[model samples]
Target: MSIYIFDGTMTGLLSCIFRAFQFKEFDVQVSTDANVQTGLFAEVIDVASNDEHAQRVWQGLKLKASDSAFKQFYYAFLSEQQQAFQHCFNFAIYVFQQQRDVSKNYGHADVLGMSQWAKQVGREKHRMEAFVRFKKCQDGLFISLVSPDFNVLPIIERHFKARYQDQRWLIYDEKRNFGIYYDLHKVHQVQMDAGAIDRQTASGHSQSFCIELDDEEVLYDQLWKDYFRSVNIEARRNMKLHVQYVPRRYWRYMNEKTL
Candidate 1:
């Protein structure tokens, strides 16, 4: 038994595949260094990320896999689940070992697992795109805090960048402790201390920012909440259905929900 530990990156995972073939190790378990399991009988191998090796494996997969299959594999990796990583690793191995396309082979556990994982990450990506709400800062920067179940900021960046091209915006993932910032020109990944944000805002309950907010932002929030209340039909309310569509976790980012 062989245990292949990687750095939990796409490149690292691909490098692991390259090393697996290089060493002729077929029976292997993939794990990130952070989640490595101890097995006294298993031979442990640490796969370092190598761009050349990764690209070689990627190019080979591209030749064997369809475009949709390629996307599914990438989306599954973005899920960042330990099990998903192992499935992705196995899926890559399966793709190279077989002569025919294996993407639609739902009978295979890795193939089916990758497909299901990709769908879940895709749904999270769309949800983040739809539910994200931003507030204007005194410095002309719009900021929003999010803690999505998956690492979805990478997938949702294009939507926000295209929609808010004229303004500077920051979408911070409190769970991941990183954010994407668009400077009206390009998008950049950023990291900062939570102290810069208001405790209430970070908690998803209050709009009071630690830093100065745009003077009209509070009025805008109130007006929006008032409009929401006015249009809400209390008698026709269906909490169960509403919560089904918009889960309780997302309520923190909604102004009407906070009110």
Candidate 2:
């Protein structure tokens, strides 16, 4: 058994595939920094990520597999589940073995698993987009904090960038300790602390984080709460359906939920 350790990026995984094919190494296992379980009998090989080698494998996969397969495989990687690399590796190998596209081959465990995992990741991405609420900071930046189940900051970048093109904003993932910032021109990933305004325990504004750039922001919060209340009918309210759409776990990040 041979264990290949990589940096846990798509390029890293593709680079491993390049090496594996070059050496005809079949009995293989993949280990990423986030998911490493060393085996006693396994010969450990450290893989250096090379974009050229990775691109060759990627282009080969595109020729051998369908576009849907390629997309699901990508989403599966983002799922970040345990052994996700293993399944993705297996699926890639399977695609290379076949001359034509076999994306709907549910008989293959790797194919089925990747498809299912992609759905889970896609659902989480949509939830992150809807649940994220930005607070104004004194620096005139719109800052939002999120701790999603999967690494979905990448998926929501385009949505926010297009929606708020004129504004400077930051969407911080507290769980991962990283954030994505857009400054009118382009978006960049940022790494920093949550800030001194740790908690929002104020009367009308209570959430995971607090930032006050403009006092008018407080009035906006109140208006949002009042709008929700005015439109809501007590007799027609359904907690079960509401919880289904906006899970209780994510309620901590929503200011309107506090009201």
Candidate 3:
């Protein structure tokens, strides 16, 4: 058994495929360097990420794979699960070994696994786009904090960038400790200083940012809450149906949910 260790990047993953084919090492297992596990008898190989090698494998996959298969490969990778990486590794190898498109071969575990994982990641991306609510800061920047189930900040970037093109905004993923900043023109990945803000406060459900909110933004929040309150019909309330559509985990992002 051969174990291939990579740097946990899309390029690194493609590089792994390139090496696997280059050496004709068919029996293999894939893992990121950050979370590598090995068997005592297994032969372990460390893979270095190379753009040229990655691009070659990427171009090859694109030529052989159907459009849906190509998209499924990327979305599955974004899932960030160790099992998903293994499925991607196996799925790519299967694609290269076959002459026909095998994307719909649900009987094959790897193909089905990749499709299922992609759907889960895709669902999270849509939920983040719907639930994210930006709070206006004193400096005129809109900021929102999210802790999604999957690593979806990259996937949600285009949606926010297109929708809020004229304004500057930052959507930070507290779980991952990183954020994306949109300056009227482009979006950039960012990180905040450890002591830059307090993550929690006495009221456990507050935004708790170190920065101050604009006075008008606070008033706008209150008015929005009042509007929300006025529209409620206690008799028609359906907790089960509401919770199904708007999960409890995302309540913190909605202004009306805050006290």
User: What TM-score against the true fold does each predicted structure earn?
Assistant: 0.94, 0.89, 0.94
Model 3 per-residue lDDT tens digits across residues 5-87: 89889999999999999999878999886456678898888899999999999999899888898898899999888899999
Local error of candidate 1 at residue 245 (angstroms): 0.6
Q: Local distance difference test, per candidate?
A: 0.88, 0.82, 0.89
What are the clash counts of all predictions, listed in order? Answer: 0, 0, 0
lDDT of 1 by residue, 1-259 (tens): 8988888889999998899899888788888864577778988888899999999999998998888888899999999888998888899889899999987788999999999999999999988888888999999999998888989898899999999999999999888899999999999999999767764544556545577789999899989999999999999999999999998888777888774
Better of 1 and 3 by lDDT: 3
Q: Rank the candidates by TM-score, best first.
A: 1, 3, 2
Give the residue spans of candidate 1 off by over 4 A. 199-204
Clashing pairs in 2: none
Top model number, lDDT: 3
Worst 10 residues of 3 by lDDT: 199-208
True lDDT of residue 145, candidate 3: 83
What does the lDDT come to for candidate 2? Answer: 0.82
